[model samples]
Target: MNHWLTAPILIPLLGGILQVFMGYAPISLRRTLAIATTVLTLVSTIVLLVLASDDAYRLYAFGNWQPPFGIVLVLDRLAALMLVLTAVLALFCHLFAIGGTDEGNRQFHSLFLFQLLGLNIAFLTGDLFNLFVAFEVLLIASYGLLMHGGGRARTVPGLHYVVLNLVGSAVFLIAVGMIYSVTGTLNMADLAQKIPTVTGENLSIVKAGGMMLLVVFALKAALIPLCFWLPKAYARATAPVAALFAVMTKVGVYAILRVFMLIFGNDAGTLANLGMDWLFPLALITLTMGVIGALGADNLKTLVAWQVIISVGTLLAPIALGSTAGISAALFYLLSSTWTVGGLFLVADMVAQQRGSAKDKIVTAPRMRNRTFLSVLFLLGAVAAAGLPPLSGFFAKLLILQSAMAGPQMAWLWSVILIGGFFTLIAYSRAGSIVFWRTVDGHIEEPKPLGGNVSTAAGALIALSVVMVVLAGPISEYTDATAAQLQNPDGYLNILNTPMVGEDG
Candidate 1:
């Protein structure tokens, strides 16, 4: 067993447990522990990424049991990429939280680490049952984090979030049971091998199960009709919690990519490409709705929350294409949008803090103390979020457009994405002008002082967008390779059929 394969999951679990015991300790000590653990997880995930670059599938099975019979964690380029992304986002958010947000609850660090633990498990698990388990873990942790500040604003949205996820969880279990009844296996690789052989009534059941799974993932991804819970829930959370929740949607997207492309892929005979037809149209509609929401939003945090849906729509449209190029483009855009939006959430919070009672509303207020600095950060985020040139978003969207050139829905994809971006640009411009440029011409109110830790945290995340642009060549190549790896399911499926080294078959 590769012990490192478990590091991402274990580190966070251990950290959260330790944090629970340290509930009475000084906040500084708890913060130190959480940051140290996250940094360690980041290093481990980066190492895994380098190891996975060799294009080999490594599995860590529990209790000496092989896949299809034991719980396992699978490592590949895609999982590694997600792990690193989560850790990076969590580190910055944790830094910002310690600056003051942690004061909201004594167990804040504990809940935060547990949330990371859940996200890491969702990415690394090798079977459908464990995936469901991962969802519950994260959702439970998120329940506490979302309600950390404990006000009616967080309470109402948090209630909706909890209830919706509970429904999703039930649906997820039913779908898993249905699939298991038909295939006698829940391991992803085992299902991939067996799904092709299912026929008649069993095949129909499997198909229904697959569609049910799509519904659950769609809800998690906050796609269209199921997305209404996101804007309010996200906008009401404390900044650090909201920023971390940015990657929560991607977990659903990742599941779609892993399950659909591997189990119900082209080789699945009667069930091949099971949900692709529905995914494409829904993705486009989600994009349109997201931009519309942004246009109508009256608060900065709400606008950023809407942008998350926009990013989701942007990501899934490419992914729904199910081509190597399309998947690659989506991966690049995923990194760009996740970091950018996470930064924007932090920036929104900072701006709201300085505005006193106005608190992130779009209406004009006295000019802020750090007006120039905050405006610049907000501008950089706006440029990237709007897909303007010389930033990661521009390149990511360009790649998506290029990938769609040969698809049947090329025109639809092109029109929706480009127009969505245009509207996004206008929305941000309106907010920016009202908040930063059109401030009241009078003595500035006693704005709160910005903390170095929070400012650095937000700035670093936005700066990554510039770094992504600079490293686009190698990053694109990596995503391209990951996409190729995803397309070849044989590499993933062979894990169950192959024998472990130096062990009996």
Candidate 2:
């Protein structure tokens, strides 16, 4: 039955429903339940990661139905890695929410669980239609969470966020329809097999569908022109929600890897390497724009939001290289970037609260409470985000550079990434000094104590980032193996051809 493969998604589903029923329960109880569920999810995901490390793939077929006929869940090293990363981030975010981010919000707990549910399913699902369904689930849950506090800051951005995604959703459906119409299949494995056989006009239709889907995924990933909605929407959301959203852009990156490499990869004959040429140029531009946005941001939260876009751009650039080494490096950077940004969001919120009326604005104002502690945290985060030496980001970026050097657009990629890092360091340094290095003065309010949960949450993330730095060797090896598996989809396709147990024989 391979229940562990499905547990990540189902546990959150049941937990969210249970939370909805307990709406009238004490906040303590609701939060306790959410934390426990997230903990269980983390535990389950860890177990699956261990299993996947030993075995390349695990499949779970619902209703015991056969391939291409019924829904199935596929868990590989990449999927397991994403699930574990998501669970860890969700646990910390839930703890931060417990520290009062969920106050005055009736459905925060349930929405949090549902968000996990959607993200889990998105990572686990093996079929195209189910992937779309997972996207909707997560997007709907995000809408509620984004508007949780209900302010003009949240409301105005939320509307833009909603409209942009709605348009993305429509484009997604059209892409799905075109692919299905041409290939006569929505199952990823089936499409992988059918795509290579497509020819002439049909191949063009399939290529159009594939390209359109990339556009939709690019929108989700906050790529360049489609990325304007991310900075404001993320900056305006409450800290906990924004922290949890650190993985949202990566979801789009994941989709691109899964669909392009698996369905429209080099083996797809006429469709071999369809989008790399276009993606490479766009990815470099995205990297440039993201760094510029960070430099010009008005506040710490806005800067962190821009960092998310920068991370996306950094990841996509390597991926556009279409080499296994590039993919492996992209995977490692994805892990480091998500944790660093999520932790920074929590820190930014704490800094804002302690700054009184100054909040998180870039201009110098009053000194902050826990300035020393927050300073250290921000310093570590900046080092990581900027890819400085002795941290995970440095190694991650180094690996990408090594990979890009072997690709055709090596010079352009190297120039953009290195230059982007320089500007990012400058921006973070500027913001940090303004926020944490203020002059000692009497007008500054007495430093208020941070919530126990807030400090604990932030500390946990910092520790994780350090751990990533410490364990770089093993993590890189794992991602290398994951990329190898993705490059050869034969095993994945073979399993899809096998009948599920209890299915008529």
Candidate 3:
């Protein structure tokens, strides 16, 4: 087994436990530990990504047990990509939190690390049961983080989030049970091989289970109809926590890509391309709804939260294509949008603090102290979020458009995406004008200074969007390869079926 395959999960697990024991330590000490551990995990994931670039599968089997029976962590291009993304996002969020957000609760550092643990596991786990476990772990941690500041505003939404996820968890378990009963194994590779052979009543059960899993992932992804909780929950969360959550919806997208493509993919016989037909149309509706929500948002945080939904819709549309080009475009867009939206959340918080009584509300207030700085960051984030040109968002949308050119839904995809971008630009423009441009003549409250750590954290995330534009060539190449890797499950299944040398079965 390659020991590095376990580092992403273990590092966060150990870090959270150590911080728990250090509960009495200075906040500085805890913060330092959390950041250090996250940085280390980031390094490990980068190494794994480099290794995975060779397109080899590396599996870490628990207790040297073989596949289908042992719990395994699989290192592949996609998993490595997500691990790196999570670590990078977490590190910045951690940096931003130490600027005083962490002080809201003594257990903030611990919960944050636990959240990473769950996210990493969700990306790396090789079986369905463990994926369900990973969802529970992350959702539990999220419940705490959502209500970190503790107010009626957060409490109501947090309760809603909790109840909904609990329902999702139960559904997840039922789906897993159905799949297991029908196939006799919860290992994804085993299921992929077994699903194609299922027939009769068993086939129907498997199909129902697969669809249930889709509903669960849809809820997690915050797709329309099930996404009402996100705007409130995310809008109310502390700045750093909300920023970290920018990647949370992507977790659902990742699960859909991994499970659907690998197990229920085109090769799954009777169940081939299952749930995809529903995914594309709903994704478009989700996109439209998100744009409408953004237009109506009365606060910066709520607008950014709606942007998250828009991104999910944007991402799933391509993924629903179930083609290499479409999946590749989604992956590229995923990176750009996640980082951009996260930066926007932090920017919103900073703006809220400066605006005093007005908070993040989309109304005029006294001119902010660092008007030029915050405005610039917000503009960059807005342009990216709105998919404007000369930035990563524009390129990402271009890729999605290009991918859909030959598809039957070309006209629909083109129309919705174009219209969505136009409306997004209008929404951000309106918010920017009201908040930054239409300032009151007199000050309602004193302007607050932006902290160095806070500003740097936010700026760095936004800067990453610029970097994505510069590195578009290499990044596009990587995403293309990753998408190809996803399309070919034979490479994954063969590796899992064969035991590592010297391993005892």
For residue 212, model 2's alpha carbon misses the true position, in angstroms, by: 1.0
lDDT string, candidate 3, 1-505, tens digits = 7999888889999999998899889888998898898899899889998989999988888887788888988888999899888899999999999898898577889899999999999999999999999999998999999989998999999999999999999999999999999999999988899999999999999999999999999999998789999999999999999999999999999999999999999999999989999999999999999999999999999999999999999999989987799999999999999999999999999999888889899998878778789899999999999999899999999999999856568888989999999999999999999999898788756567788999999999999989999999999999999999999999889756666659554
Q: Compose the digit string of candidate 2's lDDT tens values, residues 1-505.
A: 4888988988999999999999889988998888999999999999999999974677888888778878999988889999999999999999989998898977899999999999999999999999999999999999999999998989999999999999999999999999999888899988989998998898888888898999999999999889999999999999999999999999999999999999888888888877878888888898899999999999999999999999999999989888899999999999999999999999999988888778889877766668899899989989999999888889899999999764459989899999999999999999998888855564556655799999999878866778998898899999999999999998789767665776543
List per-prediction Cα lDDT, in the order shown: 0.94, 0.90, 0.92
Clashes in model 3: which pairs?
none
C-alpha displacement of 250 in model 3, angstroms?
Answer: 0.5
Better of 2 and 3 by lDDT: 3
lDDT of 1 by residue, 141-206 (tens): 999999999989999999999999999999999999999999999999999999999988998999
Stretches of model 3 off by over 4 angstroms after superposition: 501-505
What CA root-mean-square deviation does each model show from the true structure? 1.1, 1.4, 1.2
Model 1 ranges with Cα > 4 A deviation: 443-445, 501-505
Off by over 4 Å in 2: 406-408, 446-448, 503-505
CA lDDT of 32 in candidate 2? 86
lDDT leader: 1
lDDT score, candidate 3: 0.92
lDDT of model number 2: 0.90
